[model samples]
Target chain A: MLIWRKTMEMIPGGTLITATPEEGRQLAMTMARKSIGAIQPEAEVRKALPPKYANSPDSLTAAAQVVALEFATIAAANKYWRKNS
Target chain B: MLIWRKTMEMIPGGTLITATPEEGRQLAMTMARKSIGAIQPEAEVRKALPPKYANSPDSLTAAAQVVALEFATIAAANKYWRKNS
Candidate 1:
């Protein structure tokens, strides 16, 4: 029983293990946001630009794609919803 | 007239000048995508993960925010859609 529990907790190639899907989702967004900041450090510029694309569906879709990409990476790292057990 | 046209083409502090809003939008998306790629180079992983978040609003919103942030930076650099006269 002890070994089984331990095995469940340890994902072979997983880089992270969240307690819930919500946590995992948030983590993925945070990672994505941090990555954007890494390349573009100007907060003021980022703040001023959302309104321009707020009504543009194409731009929003493009942005969604990026977010999805980040989430995918996080999902893989967490072994696709496998909890920390 | 010639000097006026030349002056119009040169934006004082602009880093880029697109021919139209469509072009600017495309450029901004490209920059955002490139930045994401720079931070996360695993093409296979990115390709596999978007479908997971396709139905998640929060994730999509977060992604849009990042794209908007990138668009904002690009807009500032391009002087807010200022065309190359």
Candidate 2:
């Protein structure tokens, strides 16, 4: 991941990758796959920001599904972590 | 990616990752996320193999959606790659 980060530093909007760990990996891998020697300038990162941070009884439930796929993958790969998600 | 492959070598079913590039990344990142120092020897890789290779006009259409998310993410990040899936 570090190499991916460093490799992306050659591009213009590269620093934007530090937004979040998940976002960073997504940016890094995308760049690496394209073999783009430098970060593509003007790249945009669109996100549906926190949705006003629920602050309701359902907040926890909402957050749980955010990374459902990641959790599922982890659970599937490690028996100790397996559970019905 | 290479580092991921090497790190996974210590895990029992680790070599199973090389089955496919997409599967390998999924395996490596999943392993790295869990910090499972040694590969989970009994880990299983479940997959819904190609459904008898469509061998029909719709075959191409079926494949177009398999990596829809990846292409969407790539397009969302790079204007040059942008396209409606």
Candidate 3:
């Protein structure tokens, strides 16, 4: 059984500081999408695969953790949502 | 302009050790997909958005860097591809 828990460990500190939380959120999503593209370059193939695990709770939780982790990193980088002046 | 750079910093060390590179690769992709799902739960929306940036070199490069960073972490965790006996 391939357990996904051990693959990614959250590292403290983010490299990019953004102007706002919304900017950070959008950037995080974009990075996530881009990462997917890197793994599977073919958009059609990616389109066909989501249904397989769309409703799987474990997968969803794992995915949310991934995004949350990314978002947290962005937030931390921006000093907990401090807007760049 | 939302510059995508500096949001994520590469963290050293992977938590998961796999039996093989192939397993690690699959897990990486799965994680990537799940992250996307977390950001955009609607499968239809995700399906529709790929074409807009599929051919964008910057996005692709960023995506590839994301995957590469992930793979590097996994590889490091597996001790440079050493198989678990």
How would you encode candidate 1's per-residue C-alpha lDDT over B1-85 as one tens digit per residue? 1111112322223545555434544454455455555555566766677443433334445544554555445445555432332
Please provide, for model 1 over A1-85, each residue's C-alpha lDDT reduced to its tens digit, 9 standing for 90 to 100: 0000111211122223466667767755654454444334445645655465567787567555665765554455445665555
Fnat for model 3?
0.05
lDDT of 3 by residue, A11-68 (tens): 2134466665456555666555455445445556546675645543344444444454
Pick the winner on DockQ between candidates 2 and 3: 3
Question: RMSD (Cα, Å) of candidate 1?
Answer: 21.2
**Tens digit per residue, CA lDDT, model 2, B1-85:** 1122235343336343233333333333333323322322223321233423322212222222222223223323333211210
Clashing pairs in 2: A11-A38, A11-A39, B11-B39
Best by TM-score: 3
Clashing pairs in 3: A6-B16, A16-B6
Cα lDDT tens digits, model 3, B1-85, are 0112332322212223567888867655554444444444665644655475567676555545445544554455456576554
lDDT for residue A31 in candidate 1, whole number 0-100: 45
Better of 2 and 3 by TM-score: 3
Top candidate by DockQ: 3
Off by over 4 Å in 2: A1-60, A66-69, A81-85, B1-85
